[model samples]
Target chain A: MKERIKVALAQISCKQGDKAENIRKIEDNVIKAKQQGAELIIFPEFSLTGYTVRDCVYELAETIPGHSTTVLEKLAKKTGTYIVFGMPELSEKTQATIYNAAVLVGPDGFVGKYRKMYLPTHSVFEEKRYFRPGCKAGVFDTKLGKIGLIICYDIFFPEVSRLTRLKGAQLIVCISASPATRRTFFETLTAARAIENTAFLAYVNLVGIEDGLQFWGGSRLIAPNGKVLVKAKYDEEDLVIGEINYADIRPIEAFVPTLKDLRPELFDELREAAERL
Target chain B: MKLKPSVLDLKWTEVETKIRRFIKDYVEKSEAKGIVLGLSGGIDSCTVASLAALAIGGDKTLGLLLPEQETFTTKDVEHAELAAEKFGFKTEMIDITPTLKAFYDSTPIFKTTDKLCKGNIKARTRMIYVYYYANRLGMLVCGASDKSETMIGYFTKWGDVAADISPIMDLYKTQVRKLAQHIGLPKEIVTKQASPALWPGQLAEEELGIKYETLDLILYGLERFMKTEEIAQQLGAKKELINKIKLRWVSMEHKRRMPLTTKMQYRTVGADFRLPRTLH
Candidate 1:
């Protein structure tokens, strides 16, 4: 039987340094996505804690199994839908170090967490000064499909999406807090990743300005074939839903066949060199 | 007292072209060979590389792709190579993994597997290398950062944002795309996502927790004279979302300007540096 899944990309705006308000906003979006018959819902990065907080890292950071996750866990159970969202996670052992983490919650319980791997230090981004990067690339199994979760900067690396695909992720969900100056880059990049990997890609971005950085919110869903199935309005908080048919993926892969013709040997050599160094 | 007219009212494209022309003229008059840039395979770098190639002949331009252990994919490298080939510029690839590892091992603070520290080290290291090659080759290092990044102070103080000359500094994110297509850049480079490839697996939007489209729309509205409520209404965005973006803009104001100085006297560096000094 061909499986079909309906996914919602909650491209919402968030307030900087307002954890309570951000959480409340996310909860509203989750309910809306669930009511729309979405089996899975994805929120922008740091949905609980707004991006670009000034020295509020310690104040806003929470633990993984802490209060924020508990709320999401309950929400997932209540909605009967899997939820993926971003937050600032304070390590249990070390209070000083924080991680920019993405947490997944299934209807049954918490599924998995993936921390942002890339911490940008350049213009308007000092993530390296705040959050720690994640080490592992993870894919979670869910009723919708094999799901891969990657935080914002992780999407820029094609290998991350490729590895998720190799781990049997049919759909890649990305949570982003990209600023407005780089909007076109985000839109084109997400579609390219989907086309190259032949996987369904859903990107949820924050809208509005945090601190002085402006966020250009253009949340969107791309099919395995790289066609934009649905795109959210720019600079707007929107609930974008798209239908994914597992059967359609095979046909798309058969037609394009970029993944089959990959030069793994060359990549292996590169990886080997990277690891050796 | 009312202030003089701000330069912010010009159309984005006109402003962008003026900036590009200014940089090009400065380089040409200086008798410099051409511009050299470090391509991270992100949108900013690609845009800058393309513009530099166009400003000067591809023969005089150079694009360097420096990859570390955590660089996500070879696609960016491929894109840079393809761009160089299409534009007729010299291209080089240098791996900084050994240098990064050696430095990390030598520094006690980086011994722990803290991703943030490691990522920053990589960024700073890459910047050092870019300058090393730029100085040796006698070419100006062209910066690819845009206004949004500049406004939010998202860039490293002297790392990725450092440059001898910046061509696209004034354009916003959306404006850059228009310019990229306007200048006949290939779809591959034009369409790629904006990323810093600091780690093996990373995406800019996913990491930042917001999408660029919405952010840009809000920014355009906000910067171009729309009120917060009006912006929300026009874009169909939620009021809360607009408020969030506005707050971010206000908070990150520090990143856009020079470091604050204690105004013990009436004049400070930023306040007093206004007069243009020229050697007679």
Candidate 2:
């Protein structure tokens, strides 16, 4: 377990449903991140296929350990690094259903996969139309350490990150294809989640114009203390690199012990009262 | 990147072209024959008139002079004429005193017939004439009010504020003055003190209790989301005045929004169910 892990956030523009082109860009970025001496490289939500693919989600959905993962696995091995990205996944249990999934690949090949737990179905988002909610959340042990993954909209619910951290994840990677609206919320929420969980949080967001909504690419890396170590340029494609010290999380937790002070009995009682109401 | 409020600085030529194009496209989309506006000879009205003329053409623009007997000066009529003549737009004069007096005579309910009540009557009277011509010519009424007045709720409700389109609505008074000059409006109209001309000796600055210069700076600060003390310090003005402006802005929030409707149904008009006016 390394004390400090270098992570690179690749904020890239995605052409709608252009899998080949997006894959090429992802591969190129992996090589670039490797050159920059980053152990883990991250990409925005739907970096494999693209966001806003309404019905095309069916056509774009790929199976895990499938063609796209095979390519990404080779890229990770060749670059000697770990790669995490978002895509529409064909549910293994029920192949008919699609899930917004994030795949993690390292030098050892496929590490783990996380389907987005919360499917957003609101203004400008119709993910519920195409995706099934992920069943569970857990952590993946990489060479860097125990790392957790959650797609967009999952961060809105605190339980998602908390559960991941409880499952022994030291860092959480939140990949998003978020638009400019409510951008301040995303930024503040990422920091808030990091501080609350006493875990390192890295967010990579898509940039450029997509379906008339401008995606703000203010990707950031936040320490457990809610310190923003690096933030990428807004509305522009750029690589943001930051170092996460695994040792930093220990002292932070030792000082505050937010997780240690949890009262699950009270939380369960509150949940029961809320349900009754 | 951090958002710099300096991006709001006006480039006169680009602004002019954009507004003209916007008006032109709006008129075309609304399927209105042209535009009609009440010309008060104030900088706001003159600027709107110039833009309307540039938009739909002088032949399609109609300028109305609705002057109350006591409130309007001869210089007001002359300046309005100067703008109309320069733009080559047709003008008609409607004496609004009789209309105002009719309301006063019919409803003697007001215990006090003060300047405020009378000024509102004048504004609504002019509104009637502006709409009358607009209806006659199949035209939309273009309002000449600017952002500074609108923000403070200075204009009378359903009066000069009523419009099918407010072309200069986003520009502040100072910016409007700059635009009026840039469009080659006569110096008389561009340099004149802004007045609603609803009553005699009613200057907009005096009525609003803030000069357009100071108001614009404070507004710019507000636009950039600056704190009141920061704005006051940066502009070398009073913190009290900045706070007052902010209070006025908050109090006048209703004027900026559509009337609130109770949502008893799943979808209420302007509450849950909203479609662009241009949508079929």
Candidate 3:
């Protein structure tokens, strides 16, 4: 018997540098999604800290199991829905360095944490200055299904998604604060990742203009076949939900045979070259 | 000519039309032909080309497609051609690979495989080509960069960044798409992925590591909503994405403004460069 999971993609507009308001907004959405019978509710990237609050990094960054995560833990327990969200998590031992982390809070407690693997340093992104990139890819086993969470920039690279899929992730969730100018590309890339990996993808993006830039929210859910089951409105805030029949994924995978066609030898060669560099 | 007082209260569309008309009249009064823009086949260039074609007839507007060895796909070239065809302009393609190679071969700094340096050189090389053509053709160099790209210093310093006039500098990428569609751009040109074509298989998103969609969202969240960490939590976006965006805002602070001055005196440039010019 295949498990059926209901997922919700929250396309919310984040206020820049305002922690209190953002938390209130998330709590409200979590309750709303749970009430709608969603098993898993995902938010956009960096939901706690607004995307462009450059000067507020040290001010807003908190330790996991600290204020923000503790609140999320309580919310998950109350809602009985798994919550996956992004935050600037400060390491316990290394207080000076910060990690761009995604927290998974289940009904019991904090279930898992996945730090961003790819730290973009060039052109409108200078992550090397602020973040220490995570070294490993993570997939958490949940009652809903095997879930994988990758941050915004991590989705651009195939290996991150591939690695998570290899770890047996049936559903891959991406939280994004993608802007309007790059919405078209994001949509294309997200769909591609889902199709190639043979996994259900739920993508949530931040909407509205922050600072001087604009975000075009086209949050969407893609089936394993690369078909968009549900897409959120761009440039507007909305709650998007979709039902996944895990039974259907196997047939699609059997027909397409993408996973069966293994080019590991070629990938290994490419990996070796990257390692040499 | 008398200026109407009621014009101040006009709707935004009316005001925009008036401003455009005023500029057009001024250009015509000066006896200048239509604007000349270098169409790089990227979003910025396409916007500039469309505007130039609209400002002046196709005959008056000139669109130049500059290509180098690093140009990943000919689709960019195709898009530029289609834009010119749709907008009614003269289109020309010039390969700058030889010129760039010549410069690289001569320079001692080319020993190392510094992709950044090489990329910058390509941009500069393209700029030189545009300026040269614009000069020979006696036309102004229209810039296609948007405020989003300019704000974070994503553009080349003196390369694709150089321009005599920029029409869309204040518009965000989202706004640019809206305007592009509003202007009746062909689907082929409008749907194309953006790239500088600096290197083979080079995509703007892949190179930046941060998708523009997310970058734009963060920028919008910070600038408009003023919701800091709360927004991040609400969206479930990675803190790293936020951090990266913030880092860009801080690091590229220099690119967003005029060159800094030592401020030795009270009347230095940038701080106080305002002086009434006396024309003889």
Query: Which candidate comes out best when scored by lDDT?
Result: 2
TM-scores for the candidates: 0.53, 0.55, 0.55
Complex DockQ per candidate: 0.01, 0.03, 0.01
Model 1 alpha-carbon miss at residue A103, Å: 0.8
- For candidate 2, list the clashing residue pairs, or say none: none
Shift in Å, residue A190, candidate 2:
1.0
Rank ordering of all candidates by lDDT, starting from the highest: 2, 1, 3
Which sections of candidate 2 miss by over 4 Å?
A93-95, B1-280
> What would the per-residue lDDT of candidate 1 be over residues B2-116, giving only the tens digit for each residue?
1112222345454444455555655764566677788876667877887677667677677778887667477888888777777677778889889987997787666546776
2 or 3, greater by lDDT: 2
Please give the lDDT score at residue A207 for candidate 3: 78
Candidate 2 structure quality by residue, lDDT tens digits, A1-277: 8879999999998767888999999988888888888999999999987787766677789899899999999999888999999999997677569989999999999999998999889877878877888978858987899999998789999989999999999899999999876688898899999999999999999986554456788999999999999999987899979999888998999888999999888888878988999
Displacement of residue B74 (Cα, Å) in model 1 is 64
Task: Give the TM-score (vs. native) of candidate 2.
Answer: 0.55
**TM-score for the A-chain in each candidate structure:** 0.94, 0.97, 0.95
Docking category of candidate 3: incorrect
Question: Scoring model 2 with DockQ, what do you get?
Answer: 0.03
